[model samples]
Target: MEQTIPPAESSIVEFKREWTETARETFCAFLNSHGGRVYFGVSDDSSIVGIDKPDEISRTVHSIFKFAIHPSAESYVQTETLKIKDKNVVMVTVLEGSEPPYYVTIKDNNKKGRVCYIRQGSSSYEANDKEIRSLYRKGNPIPYEQRASANQNLTFLTLAEYFKKSNVQFNEGKYQTLGLKDLNGFFTNVGLWLSDQCTAETRVGFFLGNTKASESDGIFTFSGCIIEQFCKIRDLLRNRFGFKNKIEPYTLSSEGYRNEIADYPELAIREALINLFAHRDYSFENAQATVTSFSNRLEFLSFGGLPQGVTKEMMLLGISIPRNKTLADILMRLSAMERYGIGIPTIFASYENFSVKPALVCAHEYIKLDLPRLQQIPSDLTERERAIVSYLKQNGASSRKQLQDFVKVSYGTVINTLRSLEAKKIVVKQGAGRDTKYALTISLR
Candidate 1:
């Protein structure tokens, strides 16, 4: 029995006269490529000649896929016999190989090697060295940026605006360049994160007192693309505190100036926000980054602890390794963060003058950073006096000369400030006369 074929050969569809050893090469090709279908008993032209033993051919195809192809692609390949005008054509359907560089087992150059094939145009041929290496890279562990997104239909208005504001060109032409889409025209996970359809959010809760013991305050959530959320959260966190002006005490001369102090250091808050976004585990759908602002403290909670073998001590020492390199790079391009190890150190430095330092609880599942509210800085400190106390807090015990030079003040002024701070219990004097040195009583955070 025979019937006229309906169409010609194409990239995803192929015609074969019979099931031969060469058919394995094409099977390997379909697995290596985006997957395809091969119809046997069909000629190169739109012609079909029925196979005499359809049962035997089907059995042979299954046996080859099960035993011959590398990594056993039998699970992804299936064969069926179809009736075309009284003629039977055996059709084999193949799905894209989960593990790539699918090849037929063979011997080449006196060594056991693989015979790899890839689809090009309407033909399948042996893959070159470059193509084979590429296939090997697409292996058991795929990078997050390369994985296809579950949602294909996505919007990027927010992302486009962010890119534009950063003066970076963002268009369909840059999809692959920016790793927003894969080579097969599917949106990648990176695209999903940058798109308006992103599911991650930032949650903030306002609680009473220094704890969340009783919930009567309020809560706010920021969503959409992580970029937009970052901006919104940054602004919200920034505006929560106001400034205070400090002046020198008992200064008869015009040596005093206004010292603007903030409840929380601006740099510390910014760094915490950036770390929350760039390093926290984005893979976990059950948790999100959050902040809790209480009357006496601010706490930041994030999912996923320090990476393997990393500890809290190392983090405090400014050792940082980003969990997502690609996202980190993108954020850096936007000038959103610093490259070196300044973030954590800056945060710790902001609390340098406090007796009770900030606390960090690092666990396997999550990390919690607790920053005590503004408490150490006395409102009456003059600009020069505050500078002296800050220097002592950071540099430990310092001589009168060191303090005078650091604050660019007269030697007598430095002595008076140190005496005043010592009387206030903020600074402690050591030794006597020329051996005198002052140190902050408050421990570094």
Candidate 2:
């Protein structure tokens, strides 16, 4: 008799009772991250059930590696068989591949079923377009925008018109200056993005409420030219989130002009939108830059996290490392971006006079900039109303019980306050009965 011990499941270790098509995803994941090993004929509890026909299984694994994995993953994989307690176990070892961003081809899907995967802790997840782009860039230092476009027959009517409007020449020589063409005179991805005939899917959605599940107030999709899309999105955002003026008689002067108060600062919104479009990862086909407006805040979500070595604190300190340098340069030439990397800091400074500050969140694969609404509270509102409004502004929607806990008031008092706020259109009630949650209403005026 023989004894064997198997390792527990971990970031670099996985156990499978048998081979499955899904295992190919894990294989790609291991190749994307640090190398990892997979044990076949093993249980989740480290029990070795053993595999039947180990040699045939090994051959089948080899065939899968040869035919299934894309961009050649065979060099990174090795297989062996070991007998313990008279049971045959197959161990498949996978090393981190030098040519990363590997995808496993699944024919069942579309014609091109190249899906990339990445290992996250103990689980494997499908890599987003941004991650795939990052892997491609990591394997090769050249940025995606600099790469030649697959569609060679591209036109730049929109781009030419933009240059004419900006008082910049749009001759053939300017193409090289703007990164529109490579040395061989082929249209680059940047050229395709700027072309009038380009077909990149960019979209914007305005929801009635804060969350995506809320009813859509408006939805707009942009294609064709990148500059045109940028202008369209900027105009739509400005029209939607722009200042709403409220006229109030001046108390300081008896015969003076009225004060004009805006719902949000225009400079802050401008900087945020510019930063979002300028820094978003263009390699991501599935993900688009999104501007979501809730009642109390607006969120600008862009693909790709902070550039390597740049932190959120550094961003606040005006340190900028643009992921798409060509795009940034174009925007800078168009006068959309300033020379110094002060967009983030300028956004923060825009809200200095307001009670709520803008928030900047950097995640593993994306960045989010949240701008809080500068709503004016009615002077006649009670203390409870002010507290409830403040809570909802900071925490989004909340239930009566939750509000009561935060305000330390009676349940009836909370309910009455909520009703009063709702009556004044300050907050809107969602759902009914116990599932009820109150959210601030859109402060357009």
Clashes of each: 0, 0
User: Positional deviation of 410 in candidate 1, in angstroms?
Assistant: 56
Candidate 2 lDDT over 34-153, as tens digits, reads 989888888888888999978887887787778888778777888888787678888888999888788888655543578889999888988976677778777776677889988889
lDDT of each: 0.75, 0.77
Q: What are the root-mean-square deviations of the candidates from the true structure over C-alphas?
A: 18.9, 11.7
* Residue pairs whose backbone atoms clash in candidate 2: none
What residue runs in model 1 are displaced by over 4 Å at the alpha carbon? 1-140, 243-261, 376-445
For residue 269, model 2's alpha carbon misses the true position, in angstroms, by 2.9
Regions more than 4 Å wrong, model 2: 1-29, 38-61, 79-91, 104-141, 183-186, 200-223, 232-263, 286-288, 292-299, 354-356, 364-366, 372-445
Residue 404 lDDT in model 2? 94
- Model 2, residue 219: distance off in Å is 6.1
Per-residue C-alpha lDDT of model 1 across residues 141-200, encoded as one tens digit per residue: 666556788889988899899989999988899888777888899998778877899887
Clash pairs of candidate 1? none
* Per-model TM against the reference: 0.50, 0.63
